[model samples]
Target: MRKALTLLGTGLAAALALTACGGGNNASAPSAAATLDPANPTTVTVGATPTPQAKILEFVDQKLAKEAGIDLEIKEFDDYQTPNIALSDGSLDANYFQHLPFLEDQMKTKGYKFEHGAPIHIEPYAGFSAKHKKISEIPDGATIAITNDPGNQPRALKLLESAGLLKDIKDDSSALTLSDEQNPKKLKFEENQPEILLPLVKDPKIDMAIINGNYILDAGLNTDDALVVESVKDSPYGNFLVWRAGEETPAIAKLEELLHSPEVKAYIEKTWPNGDVTPAF
Candidate 1:
């Protein structure tokens, strides 16, 4: 099923609600940001979600821009659509909050005119441990758990795929919906809030599970027990910085270059570790 990750509950509803307030109607598609104008370095204001992106941006805000001779100002947004609207209305210079696929869905469904700069980093989704040590440790035909939400469902499946538990991903580069899984591991799914995934990881019957790094951190787990990890080298889910179409100011340009710089890559590796959130340069 072509499911959405963000349409889950009241918070998601409130988030999507913002697009209804502003953005745009079914108008012409927005243009992508062009090459940077080094002559006029602008102060770029960007909105970001916490995890890897926001944390990484702080490093750029601190270091890389000075060398590039640009000032990058970053704003933090918990909700997804607000940044897009801010970008559209000229409230913010740009944003670094979403993946390219999610951005496409947002623009097409909400009639948004958004575009992305260079792809930034990939946060590898991983099967975590609260109880089990390995996939084989998960009892045969045991009910491994996955998130019931559509947005996270595929990632859950992919974790199982890495473990040799889930099978039949027709095309690794494209989306892997549940129906595409010709053979599934003997895994059950949990519809619990993404935040509580760590607690559930302790349940004996729960077997194995998949979780995003932020929630994993929230649950008090780091890179200690990631059984099956997401592959950034050849996977399709690397994240990118999103800006309004044709809105490449000098500051945005500098931020893009900084994001791909050597220092930023090292910062991300140290922050997340073991290619969990690798720099996708």
Candidate 2:
């Protein structure tokens, strides 16, 4: 049986409500002035995935934020799109889940102007399988499941290529396809939302799935279960804190610095050893 992480029902509903509002809210962009006052810090609302992002934010809030006069109110989100939508609409003060490539793609396609802070950590993109123990065992005509978003599809394809499973993937390819020459095994590709991918790949119909690093630990799986994993020496997929292009404040900067502090580094090493989650700082 596949170990799939269960998302909070209410959280998903909230995210849906925010996303469903679309771009109809004509709220003007927030002022560029700092929202935090050192003498009287305000609570900053941030949207993040439940796994390591929210967990890390909790650590900062409990251990460091109070002393530094920073208050964080984390809003848990399961889907990637909803967080950015919330941030753009001023529903969230900030978000801490996406890497640069994903953020850039979202901005270009959706017209969201988001500015990111220093990276927190890198979640190694990995290939997992329920049908096969190893890549060599994959048969012809196998169906591979991967994320469907503009940001992740190409990265997933590149990961497959690295594993010697596919070829000719460009960095910005939005439309994913496979020709006979490019796919020697006659493999078929299926795309899905990131949140449901773990459960979706467990179906007998799917052969392999490429999952984001953030979702791996949450799904009760780790590097040990992945058929193939990305190298962490200098990977480009470090997840970072992001906000409206000009809405970044001192509190946000403090959070970013705390994320790279020695205490957080020690916590990451203790929590996810064996190169599962590498601290990007």
Candidate 3:
């Protein structure tokens, strides 16, 4: 599943690429190092979404676990809220959907603790102009459609800021809302799930959309279609696994290691293709 940014490392593995899953029967499991106990069953239950993270898990789950001598179990959740709660309640071992910033925000609002290691992947917020294929084609004052959710709206506006559609609403703003925008294009903000914005693009009324990678994937739209995209040069939105605070399981370590393994890198290369997603190992 896709997590909002704070819910945390590989360090910046080359700018910022949205990270997650992979596949293989057995190329070879890394030799059990002195670091972990092989005999103890280190099974972890991770929660995720469908494409590319969930799709990624389906690919890597079995081989990575068996190879590591750990049994990895992944649970799928289409909605964003459950996984975090599941992690909190002891219903899950860990979750692999949100980014550090998103998780941190969720923790503050919900009063739960979640953290990650390294930045995993970034699903860039791309500006998709229904009328134009290229940024140059966007006429002045076009009515762009951006998600209206409090958390995601600010993110969408940041993309608008980057696309030169709006001026800085806040200097140190890591997140944004419509109130922050100077409205260069006078774009009408339509708050809704990221997916809804795509269909609106079909209507002549909607000029553009700041679509997230998940919605882009759901719509089968490609990077080439985006008039603008999130600048990952120093982006903070990398997907990571969130374990309960004060509890670090051996399975968590195994899962983390496998995430950065050669298998996952290969999977990231195969799945994202556009180099948008990478295992933050």
Scored by lDDT, the top model is: 2
Candidates ranked, most accurate by TM-score first: 2, 3, 1
Q: lDDT tens digits, residues 1-281, model 3?
A: 22232222223311121121111111122222444545765666777766677766666665565666566566766545666666776767777777755666566656675546555567777887668877766677676776643446667777777777777755334322334347655556555555457787776877777776766776788876678888776766777766766555566766767777787878788878785565555
Candidate that beats the other on TM-score, 1 or 3, i.e. the better one: 3
The deviation in Å at residue 262 for candidate 2 is: 1.5
- Better model by lDDT: candidate 1 vs candidate 3: 3
Can you give the lDDT of residue 188 in candidate 2?
A: 79
Using TM-score as the yardstick, the better of models 1 and 2 is 2
Model 1 RMSD, rounded to 1 decimal = 6.8
- Cα lDDT for residue 184, candidate 3: 53
What is the TM-score (0 to 1) of candidate 3?
0.77
The candidate scoring highest on TM-score is 2
- Runs of candidate 2 with Cα error greater than 4 angstroms are 1-39
**Cα-based lDDT for every prediction:** 0.62, 0.75, 0.63
Structural similarity to truth (TM-score) of each candidate = 0.73, 0.85, 0.77
